[model samples]
Structure formats: C-alpha cells, structure tokens
Target: MTARHVLLLGPLLMLLGAAYLLPFLGVMRWSVTLPEPGFGQYHAALSDPLVLGVIWRTVRICAVVTVIAVAAAYALTLIWVRGGRTARTLVELCIMIPFWISVLTRAFGWLALLSNKGIINGWLQSLGFLSEPLTLVRNEFGVVVGMVHFLIPFAAFPLATAMRSVDERVLLAARGMGASRTRIFWQIFLPMTKNGVLGAALLVFVFALGFFVTPAILGGGRSVMVAELIYLRIFQSPDWGLGAAISVILMVTVGLLLGVMMRQNRGAAR
Candidate 1:
C-alpha cells in the first residue's frame, strides 16, 4: 500500500511476468498476428465444423468426467468420514497411489485393460458374456473411463477434508429425532459438504479440459478433444497460427469460468 513496499514488489512482479505472463502474452500475440495479421484465422478455425466439434466434444467429455468425479468423491468422502480407522487408511492409500503414478503411466495401463485383446475383453469372453471382443479401446468410452479415473482423486481429497470438519453432534441430534440414514445424509451431511464439492468439481473440470495423454491413448484419434486438436495443428500439420489462436481461445474460456466460480463463491460468502 506504500511506495517502498510497492517498489519491493517490482522485482518479484517482473520475475513472474518473465516466467509466466510473458509467454502467455507471446501466445496471444501469435494468435492475433500470425497468418498475415488479422482475425481471419480465428474466424477460419471457428467456422470449421471439425474444430467446432472438437471444442464441443472436449466440453462434453469434461462435464461427464466432472459429474462422475464429484459423485464418486461424495461417496468416498462419506465412507472416510464415517468408517473406522482402517477404512480411512485404505482410502488414503488409494488416493496416494494414484498421486504417485504419472499420467502417461496410468493411460498406458488403461490401454492394456481396454484393448481388443485386453484383460477385460478376455475375461468377458471367457465368461460367455460375448462371443467376440466388444469394442472398448480407441473410442469415447475408453477415454471417459481414463479421464474419470484421473479426476476422482482430485475431487475426493478436498471433500474428505471438509467431511472431517463436520460436527457429529448435529448428526446425533438428527438420529435422536429418528431420521433415517439416507434422509440424514441428504438433508444434513451433504449440504455441509457443498462448498468442498463445488471447489473439487471446478478444479477437476478445468484440469480435465487440458488433458492430453489419456484421451490420446484411449481415443486413438477418433475422439479428438480440443487439446489434442491443438497438438495436431502445431505438431502434425505445422499450423502455428491456428494452434496459437485455439490456445488463446482455450485460455480465455478457462479464465472466464474461473472468474464466474470465484464470483459465485464470494456471493455465497456474503
């Protein structure tokens, strides 16, 4: 708030700009100026059906993954909150194991499990569920499976922390009034966990938007999302302008989403 303190922040601000903001500005510059300096590239990409489809597909996939992650996180947090110590330990271990594994490693693991000759298909065929292997890998189903797996832990940890802070006295009072387990959870426990759930959903959904590996390996190019499309434009086709333009769009969209969530959160607090 004072001049001396403001001057003290100059070096750090410059460092941050150099490290992050500068590169982002460069991308924005490229998006606008590349391919002969006009808004033409943005219009071209926007009008292209394939590009529009990829953007929509990316949004759809992330939405589905967010919903699944939040639901799974809610159930998992309930177990961790109410179960014994051993159960809590097991849940913590599950979350930590995924944390340790790299994204590509897990994506490859899904490739093994979902492939035509993969374990799931082999087991199902052996059990006479199908005479032939059902198509699982290299499709949207496989991509969704992998994305949901990646997001569940992200969405659960925060909810678990929130659940731990919930007062048990409220639940006991509800029980004394003879509320059923389902009714109590729906009316009391879950409402208390709403903030955590919203935060987790926002985090997971944003992260899911930028996902690259799981969709790539599992989708096999058939179910291309916006991130993969950006990769294709830059690496595969050498369309730097288009790629930069798309990147700008993605970043702007993410920024708008984050701003909306923050505004809603502040309004709720008020």
Candidate 2:
C-alpha cells in the first residue's frame, strides 16, 4: 500500500517483465516484420491448404483429447471423493506419479506399448489373436492415447476440488426420498460438479492445443499438430515469419479460451 512496499516489489516486477513479457513481444513483432514485413505472412497462412489442414487436425485432436481426459478424470475424482482412505491414496498416487514423470518418458512408454513390433502387438501375436499387428503408433490413435495419459492429472485435481465442495447430505436426502441411483447421479450429483467439469475441460483443451512432445514422439511425424508444425517451420525449415504467425494464432486462441473461462468462473461465483 505504501511507496516503500511498491519499491520492494519493483525488482521482481522488472525481472518478470524482462523474462516473459519482452520475449512474448518479440515473437509478436517477428510475426509481422519477418520475411519482408507487412501482414502477408498472415494472409498466406490463412489461405494455405497445408496450414489449414494442420490447424483443423490440431483442433479436432485437442477436442477429442479434452473430452476423453475430462470424462476419465471425473470418474477418477469420484473414486477419490467417495472411496475409502486407501482407495483415495491409490488414486492420488496413480494421478500424481504420471504427473511427475517427464513427458518424453511417457511418450516412449506409450510408443513401446502401441508400436507394431511393441509389447501389445507382440503379446497378441504370440497368443495367435491376430496374424498381424494393429496400427496403433505413428497415427492419430497413438497421439490421442499419449495426450489423454498426460492430461488426466490436469483434469482430475481441479475436479477433485469441485467434487469435495459438494454437500453429501444433499445426496443423502435425495436418496432418502427414494431417488434412483442413476437419477441421483445424472441429475443431482453431476449438476453439482458441472462448473468444475467445465473448468477442467477448458484447462485440458487449452493445454492440449500447445502439446508438442507427446504428439511429436507418438505421431512419428505422421500425425502433425500445430505445435509440431511451428517447430518444423522454425527449426526444420527456417521459416521464422510463418512460424511466428502460427504461434501468434495459437496464443490468441488460448487467450480467448481463458477469457471465456474467467467470465464463466465469475458468473458461477454469483
């Protein structure tokens, strides 16, 4: 509140600006100024078929990953909320263990399981279940599996916070009135956690949009997404202007999603 307090915070504020804000502004500048300037890069990006395809694939994959992650997290949160202490501990460990693992490690683990010559296919072949291996890795299916595995924790913790806030007595009362178990879950229990579910879904979807490692590794360059595309443009192909423009588009998309999430959270508080 005092000038002394403001002075105390000044160094930290400057450090943050120098570290994050300046770099962000530089990226924004490169999008317009690089490759002979103007907004020509944006125009080319919008009209280019390859760019359009990559953007569409990224959005579609992220949507699928978000839906699956949120649903799976909701189930896991239910167990954590209602199960015994031992079960809660088990759930916590399951979620947190994967959360702490490196994304690259997890991607390789999935690759080992899903690849044609990998564990799953080999096991199936040995048992005579199939003459050939299923096409699992290096495609959209493999990318989805890896993304969902990585995102489940991001979706679960927020949902647990929401679910824990619900009044157990309300569910008990509904049960006392002879409400069917299905009815109670579908109508009462789920509605109580709706905001949390929405919040988790938005969080997962936004994170999925920027995902780079798992998609790149599992996809084997076959299932390219926006982040991977950005990398190829900047590093592999040396097209800084196009890469920066794509980065700007991704940043704007995330910003709009966060703005919507904030407005929804405020409305829910009311």
Candidate 3:
C-alpha cells in the first residue's frame, strides 16, 4: 500500500522466488526437457497399465485409511468432549505420544510387530488362538495398518479442535429438551463437527496419496504405490522424464486439493 510496505516485502518476496519458486520451475522444465521434449512422458504415465495400477492402488489405500482414520478420530473426539479429565488425559496422551515419534521408527516398529515371528504372532500362537502365523506384514494389510497409524493423529487433532469450538450450550439445550444421547450425537454433534471431520479426511487422504516411507518399507516393494514407482523411475532407472511427469501430476493433484481447501475456508469465514 505504501513505499515502506513495498520495501519491507521486497526481500521476503525475492527470497521466496529464489528459494521456492525457482526450484518448482526447474522441476516443471525437467518434465519436458529430459529425454527430448514434448508430452511423451505424461502419455506413458497415463497409458501404462503399471502406472495406472499404482495410481488406482494409491486411491484405494488412501480411501480405506481415510475412512478408518475419520471413524477412529470421531470416537476419540467424542471421548475428549464428553469423558472425564482422566479419560481426556489418556486420549491426549494417545494423540500426543505418536506425534513425537519419527515416521521411520513407527514403520519399523510395525514391521517388528507384524512379521510372521513377531510379537503378535508369538502371543497368538502361545494362546492357541491360531494354528499358524497369519501373513500380516509386507502386504496391503500391513501397509494400510501403518498408514492408518500415521494418519489417526492428523484426523483426531482437527476434530478435537472442531469439537471444542462447538458450543456446549447447544448440547445442554438439546438435553433439557429431552433429546436422547444417540439422537443428539447423530443430529447435533455430527453436524457441528462436519467441517473438521471433512477437513481431516481430506488432509489424511492427500497425505496418504503421496505416502512413501511406510508403504515402501511395509509394503515390501510388492505393493508399490505411485510415489515408490516414481522413486524407482527417477533413481533406479534412467527415466527421469517419467518420474518428473508423475511428480507434476502429483503436484497438480495436491494443488487442486489446496485450492478447494482455501475456497472452503473462505466460505466458512463468510
């Protein structure tokens, strides 16, 4: 608005342009430059069955993880909203403890627990619950489990914020009017927390789409997702163009979600 403001903003704008915008521009350039020019890489990405399968698998896994994460977060939010101090403390600890741990550590921990001779199988065998160890790790089930573990916190934290922001007087008034607990929760509480729950679901889904580490280690290369396939293409093979094409696609998908999120926030503010 003024010379002083322009002077103050110039340095930050320049820094952002140099540090962030230029690198993104480089990636965009590489998508077309590597292995000659044109849209051949993108055509391969969309036409190849392998690439298409990976994208479909990613969508399916993310959908399952989002559903489970949202449902679990909903239950946790309910406890945090309605339960006593001790219960709230326990829920807080559950959400907070994993937030501090590294993703790699968490993935390896799941690996140790889910392997054939892992702790869970040992316990089950000792208790005679199963005749043989179940195939748990290095598959879709293990990948989904690890992903859900990572995403639950993302889901819970936002819903908790939303539940807290909801006016308690609304619920109290509903109670005074003789509304049943189930009815109040379904009708009032659900509607009130809709924004947070949907926001968390979208957040988790987007994060899960680009997930690499857990699926990489836990999926055991058998269940390769788009991110891992991109990794292999870029690093293991000489096809940097294909990798760049997929990266651009992924970036576009994330950008679209971000745009929708911004629109939603603007509407909420309005």
Q: In terms of TM-score, which candidate is stronger, 2 or 3?
A: 2
lDDT of 1 at 166: 80
> Which digits, one per residue and each the tens of the lDDT, describe model 1 over residues 1-270?
999998999999999999989998998888888877988779978999989999999999999989988898788777777888999889878777899999999999999998999999999999999899988978889999999998888888778777877889999999999999999989998898787788788888889899998999999999999899999998999888899899989998889888876875675456
lDDT of 3: 0.90
Clashes of 3: 0
Residue 59, candidate 3: C-alpha displacement in angstroms: 0.7
User: What is the total number of backbone clashes in candidate 1?
Assistant: 0
lDDT by residue (tens digit), candidate 3, 24-71: 788778788889899888899999999999999999999999999899
Q: What is the alpha-carbon lDDT of model 1 when measured against the actual structure? A: 0.88
The better-scoring model by lDDT among 1 and 3 is 3
Which tens-of-lDDT digit does each residue in 137-219 have in candidate 2?
A: 99999999999999999999879988998999999999999999899999999999999999999999999999999999999
Give me the runs in candidate 2 sitting further than 4 Å from their true place.
Answer: 1-9
TM-score of each: 0.92, 0.96, 0.93
Better of 1 and 2 by lDDT: 2
Candidate 1, position 189, lDDT: 89
Residue 213 lDDT, candidate 1, scale 0-100:
88
